[model samples]
Target chain A: MSGGYPKGRIRREDLISAAAVVYGEAGYHGGSLREIAKRAGISHAGLLYHFPTKEALLAAVLERRDAEDADREQLGVPPGLEVLRRFLTLAEHNARHPGIVDLYSRLAAEAVTPGHPAHEYFERHYRDARHRVRDSLRVLADTGELRPGVDPDEAALAFIALMDGLQVQWLTTPSEVDLAGALRGFLQTLLTVPLQP
Target chain B: MSGGYPKGRIRREDLISAAAVVYGEAGYHGGSLREIAKRAGISHAGLLYHFPTKEALLAAVLERRDAEDADREQLGVPPGLEVLRRFLTLAEHNARHPGIVDLYSRLAAEAVTPGHPAHEYFERHYRDARHRVRDSLRVLADTGELRPGVDPDEAALAFIALMDGLQVQWLTTPSEVDLAGALRGFLQTLLTVPLQP
Candidate 1:
């Protein structure tokens, strides 16, 4: 089907990008691979030649989105309290791209089902994020940023919960939620209050 | 289909109950109204006669779920700080019913899309929940339950966020997440501290 190998790779990338948009808009079950093919300006068969199946396409799309985000953010080595500010920046970035954020929020909820295609992705995502955030909070506590008696691990859990919970509300009523502002307010509280145990 | 009979009303109730089960298990997009009809022991045509379309059936199911919940809990007159205790009881009850919780989380996420069938339901749900929780928190603050510097509105927002955030993680990894325990911990913090601004 491909006269040139490089072009075929490019086509595959195009399909994944298009599929991301479709998945973001329609969600996993509601999204159609054929519709993705149309958006990518390729025959459905040609799209299948690269992805082979909807599950394969989904995996590829998720993988690519993560890779692209890591590259764009260059989110390397933690910077302690400064790292919290980075989350606000990321939230601002996400607000600009509601489609991707909506897709993620929707999939995260759907993946609660152990058998859902994206189940493993979400489980790993939450576990890693939780540990990383906890470690960062510990760094703050060690540096005397957190108030006395505030357990870093507990703070981490509550902080992450606030972020995720705000996302759910934000997605439902975008106009009513100031995603980054809410996080900023919470961070200020963490700094100012003892957040007693 | 009705023939001026009470049986039609009973059938509608049966269909809504069945649909709730189906939706809870498979989510809105994954759920099939026909399957709901089958479970209700009614023909597909009869189901349609009762609920003209899948969206109509979804609305009915949601309405019934709300009504039954209100009846069971009699959550009409907000009982101030006791309302916080009610949330813990509700979380414990939810822990025993993963299907409904999963369904709710899934639908809440799905309805993030402005055009989704359940979008209005979620938007209204959040607005109402936030207001009610805020109002109850104010009652507590007025009764000297809250410490100095505590803002009822801010406390309400954060409280709701924690409950929702905990629900998402709990649904994914039930054994690791003690939903009620987490909420209880947060509630204790709210009572013991000012949650400094």
Candidate 2:
């Protein structure tokens, strides 16, 4: 990324960031590549040189977000309770990044239909997300940290659901919702032990 | 509505239904008025005569859906845990109606951004929705049905989030999620008594 084309790398990042903003505001279908180029301070051909198509740009954007998450959470590093703890941290992280939240909320909603470009991406994303949470829950269950009679599978679904659902409300009316606090309160209901700092 | 032109009412219904499908599939920013007109089997001019603008059509579509929900749920009538029960029933109902779920999921997510056509509408919608759920929880608290130490305000936020979050998962991979069953299990965790049929 640095040796042959350092300027190219910077330009690509600029385009992706600008694309995220446009797509976040107007959604994938409604967002225009021309507008993205304008926002990125590049020509249309220059933008296309980096991302051959709009779908390709979207894929890059989505991949970058996941990579940032994986790195930030150190996912699968310590495993178990730490993963769940990271998710709470993730909620706190998301509260400050409204642009990222808007992008995800819009794309996930649109991708529900069968033929959307990102449909399969989101399906896999949620499946992986659930698996990660459920694995941590299993760890808690084995350690006697999880409450008795709590099904890991069901709890995972509800946990993931709560996180996703809270974003919508928070974005709609940020003044009314304490996103991180609500998430922490929810976790207290499922576990017997305190979340370690 | 019926006296002057019975045909007008039926045609309007058809347009609204078609608009829902188009908007659900592509979202408000991406969905086209022409496409809606085509799907409803009417001329573009005829569609414009009824709708005037895309934003106006969207308002009608949203208003109609709310009216149907209000009618079906008998909302504000026989309030309390019954309202919660009705929400469980509503999940069952939503399971049967994918299109309705699609419309709501897509619109709500898209409306998160400021300046979107349906932005304020969703702002008010979530506010009213949370209020209804909180009122029901208050009733449960008074009757000693709510779990001790469970804050009704926090519980309401989580409840709404669960419902909203479940829709995205269900829509992404329908075969994997049992929307109504998951909702029931979450309610079990919150309430002391079994939900009465």
Candidate 3:
């Protein structure tokens, strides 16, 4: 799958990667297709071949990021603590991908509109991610990993909120803060459950 | 100061407020002076009379929002717990003002440029805000409201990160999540040392 593109043929994944970099640096509105193409070393037509429009390209960039994140984390139906670990790992990875962070921030602001394309994506993404976290907490509860009578749903929501909130701070002040470390410390404290060594 | 505009004169504050709303809804590029004037029930000349340029208008909008936030929270130098309470209150207030949130998001995205007007605003905003938070934590530590030997700076950074990360999530999924409740819960857990209730 990696080697299928010819020497000059812009691979879909490569195009998306380039788009992410451009979007991250300049924002969706600030970035231009021509610039993304220039960065990718391809013509505008060539870039548009993979992504028909800027909107499509933005959606593709976000979708590819989500898929890559899932793959990188190998995120699965793990127990709560394990899920928390995966979530933190993903946040750490996002620290390196400022583009994805910016894209998420931009889309989030835009999502306030009733029918933005990314609106449904963000909505479903949160819903599913929250459910996964909740299920993990349930497993931890069953195994006595969490304190008795802890509300998994609330805990999961708080955990997700923490992750989401930190990214915004990181974007504005990347030089002064270690967002991943902060989150890890907070999560470690929350996960009173003993880890399987 | 409240009557600074005089009767029937559109105050500078009113123009700034209208600019914030226009920029928040239509984005900086998409928003125009004419539209802002229309929103303010004034002519374009009237809008420009207060703000010499679009950049000036943007700066005023951002500054005005910050002032309003500071006034509403009555945020001042305080202990860590008090700082946390003020931060949470301000965040809740911000959540209610989706327009300001949107404007901040847009400006943050634009701030990637080293010399963008909002760039300095954000850089100093975070630096000063973090310093204030750290100072508050130091006070808390001195009063034994923090766990012994805990790093106040790290705690401050973590709390700020949590707020920023949570705001992103809240904006992304406002319909389904109670951002204030989630933040309160997270902060409660993060504070290991019990204060005198």
Best by DockQ: 2
lDDT of 2 by residue, A44-137 (tens): 9989999999999999999999999889977755548888889998889999999999899989998998798899999999998888888888
lDDT of each: 0.77, 0.89, 0.72
Best by TM-score: 2
Candidate 2 per-residue C-alpha lDDT over B1-197 given as tens digits, one digit per residue, 9 for 90 to 100: 44346788788889999999999888988899999999999999989988899999999999999898878877665658889888888888899999899899989999887788899999999998888888888998999999899888888888888999999899999998899999899888888998875
Better of 1 and 2 by TM-score: 2
Recovered native contacts in candidate 1, as a fraction? 0.66
Cα displacement (angstroms), candidate 2, residue B191, comes to 0.9
Higher lDDT: candidate 1 or 2? 2
Tens digit of per-residue lDDT, candidate 1, span B1-197: 54566988888889988888887666688788789989999999989999988899888878876886667666676657666666677778888888778778878877888788989998998888778777877887777777556666666777777788878888876766778877776666656443222
Clashing pairs in 2: none
- TM-score for model 3? 0.83
> Candidate order by lDDT, highest to lowest?
2, 1, 3
Q: Tell me the lDDT of model 2 at B117.
A: 88
User: Candidate 3 residues B1-197, lDDT tens each?
Assistant: 45455733556767877888887766665578899988888778877877778889888777877888888898874556877788888878877876666677666655645666677787888777778878887877777676664577776776665566555556777777776776676555545664224
Rank all candidate structures by their TM-score, best first, as comma-separated numbers: 2, 1, 3
**lDDT per residue, candidate 1, A106-162, as tens digits?**
777877888888888878877866777777778877778776666666667777777
